[model samples]
Target: MAARWLKVLAAAPLMLSALTAAQPAQALVPYVAVPAERNLEGAGLGIAQAAARLLRIGQADDAARLAALTVQLIPDDPRGWVLLAEAQLRSNQNEEAAVSLAKARELDPKNAGILFAQGSLALKDSRPSEAADLIREGLKLDGNNAGAYFDLGNAYILMGKSGDALGAFERASKLRSDFWEAINNQALVLYEQNKAGEAIKRWRRVVGIKDAAEPNLALAAALNVAQPGNTESLQRAAKALAEDPNYVLESWQKEQLWGPRLRSAAAQLLAQPALKADVERAQANAGASDDLGDG
Candidate 1:
């Protein structure tokens, strides 16, 4: 059955294209191919598999709905519960996700994916010790889980183990080069280690992959200090402020993403006449947009 499924998956792209061509006026949407229950043997497995594919494609709400039906269809299948938890987590329904994960763990205590999700929630809740332990155990079970390593790095960062955090982030990057969060955090670790040059390099790499406002903001501040009056850095700062002015306001707080020293540095950069002017314009625009809603 696995071999047959693999063959079907290999042919799916071409088949999908032909199907799309048959309906040229409509946008193409990929769908899960589930055989009839008589052919597949387990309807619940087919539904759960579809839910997993939906979750992968950034359709978390749909995935969650399907996964809910899956658990009803096969209450004994731990995978359905785990899939539901993943979708809920993606939707930021933390408390509900925890309940689903708990049920999944009760059904399959050693499931690596359940452990990874539990670790992520623990990290988000500021329980670094528990997160670190759970994520480490999950990694031992699923050595190729890049996201588990990324969470482990976050746990280490919260624990002030910058060196260990760097190692974990590096492993995650090696596994998935496009993991921008890991690279962004790697820059944070470097900045904390007082290696401004290294941090700048990583920040540049991160921005190259995506125009993430946070990394751009951090890079602009670092460049402002490391090479005062650098034109390109000033442009980066302007772009960040224009793209995400709220970051400028929130970044001034003591609890921003960077450390105290970097935050202080960012404060200084934010005070520059040109950057401050752009941020003010952005804030005014946002205020106007909000005011329109009040009518």
Candidate 2:
């Protein structure tokens, strides 16, 4: 026993050096939509390449199947599990997807990969509480985990838990300050909570961050919601709507995002006789897509 202990003690310095030498403080891991296409390192390439190929051919079913198969083969690998979970989600097999993800978590409890999958699954399952718990646990494991925070915020929004969603998204933005999607979603949650001023503030931050037209459209929606009947709000929204390029208005179709409050707001705002001329002028801006139900 003493000899073994001495041997381990002597090897400790070498082990530490190897660990540090192999990976830098922030070494980039091989990952992306097409990992195999690039000369990347690690086990992620096979799954990523396979998924890319399948997606390119519009064979999402086969992609999902192969992704799940990859996870089965690489039980210890987190990326395979993530791909599998994503594929399951794409196929709408959410519950079964969660089960597959549980296997990944079992293999790597400390990894943020499976945690993101689990939280996304819980959110997809309409279990917000579970989703929040899973994602928070993931963030605790890795504070810089972008996917966990995004999915966590997404879960909160799905549950109509605005405060929790905003906090999660804010944490995500803090970690990756350049993530305009986080900012956009955070603003949306604020707007839903009737804090349109704060929502607009966040949206404006997104505009500053990415200068995306989508955020501007969202800002227009927020402006309208905040100052419902004001001529200034109308004009601002109308101008944004007119200047918008993605003619496929997303907010109106994102009913799962808005629910009754947004629907009522849209109906009331659209029904306004005074705003009719501008509404018609910005007719392309009415973005009704999905309907919401009590969740």
lDDT of every model, 2 decimals:
0.79, 0.65
lDDT of 1 by residue, 148-185 (tens): 99989988988989899999999999999999889988
Which residue pairs collide in model 2, if any?
A: 252-287, 252-288, 252-289, 253-287, 253-289, 253-290
- Stretches of candidate 2 off by over 4 Å are 1-48, 52-59, 68-79, 157-161, 192-194, 208-218, 225-256, 259-264, 272-295
Q: Worst 10-residue stretch by lDDT in candidate 1?
A: 32-41
Decoy 2 TM-score against native: 0.61
Q: Which structure among the candidates has the greatest TM-score?
A: 1
Candidate 2 lDDT trough over 10 residues, lowest sum: 286-295
TM-score to true structure, per model: 0.75, 0.61
Instruction: List per-candidate RMSD values in Å.
Output: 11.5, 15.1
Off by over 4 Å in 1: 1-63, 251-256, 284-295
Cα TM-score of candidate 1:
0.75
After superposition of all CA atoms, the RMSD between model 1 and the true structure is: 11.5
